[model samples]
Target: MDSMIKTGIIELEEMEFYAYHGCFREENVVGNRFLVNISIRTDMTRPMQTDNINDALNYVQVYNLVRTEMQQTSNLLEHVTARVMDSLCRHFPDIEWLRVKISKMNPPMGGQMRNVSVTLER
Candidate 1:
């Protein structure tokens, strides 16, 4: 008998954080709510067959990485999102594709908008 190879998508969605990130001085001082979402495509064969954490993408580690990056203050959501994407790629070379999104809730745009977001996919 032979095992089959397969690819799978893993997602961590709506990971919330309260971070000080913005272009305006007041916005930074006041801080705001944020959401980080990530999607990863990778080889799932080993993890599926072995049913072991070592063979799979450790999402807890991924969440930690996102949290670490979010804690680092930045002037823009784009920069934050990019840092997350870069960190994940650097740490997990096995990922076939990656997508990262950062959302700033109730942004200080002087309007009733829900949120502003930046997304990067590769």
Candidate 2:
């Protein structure tokens, strides 16, 4: 029931940033590592044929966009994920589909957990 839908994936994985994005007071004071994984499917045939950077989807631009979203603090992972997806969709109408996972590494949840993540698709 769950799998990657497209082979033509433009992926950026484990892009890490330290940010304050939790409801707790400590979370705001002590930022945590957030890893962003982005996947996009779109028409890349033209870019492949032309060999022009202009013709291709720019990863740097996408990364910057994600960074801008990540820098802003939010109390909920859902809100952060929504912002990322909304921003991407607004900018890239050509993208047929997109999926994003934002993970908070080693969160202070008072339990032993590796990470907490939220995934959004559109």
For candidate 2, which ten residues in a row score worst on lDDT?
A: 1-10
lDDT of 2 at 87: 92
Give the best candidate by lDDT. 1
Number of residue pairs clashing in candidate 2, backbone atoms closer than 3 angstroms, sequence gap of 3 or more or interchain: 0
Stretches of candidate 1 exceeding 4 Å from the true structure: 1-5
- The local distance difference test score of each candidate is 0.94, 0.91
Clashes of 1: 0
lDDT of candidate 2 over 26-108, digit per residue (tens): 99998899999999998877766677999888899899999999999999999999999999988888999999999999989
Residue-level lDDT of model 1, residues 67-109, one tens digit each, is: 9999999998899999999999999999999999999999988
Best by TM-score: 1
Error of 2 at 15 (Å): 0.3
Superposed model 2: Cα runs more than 4 Å off: 1-7
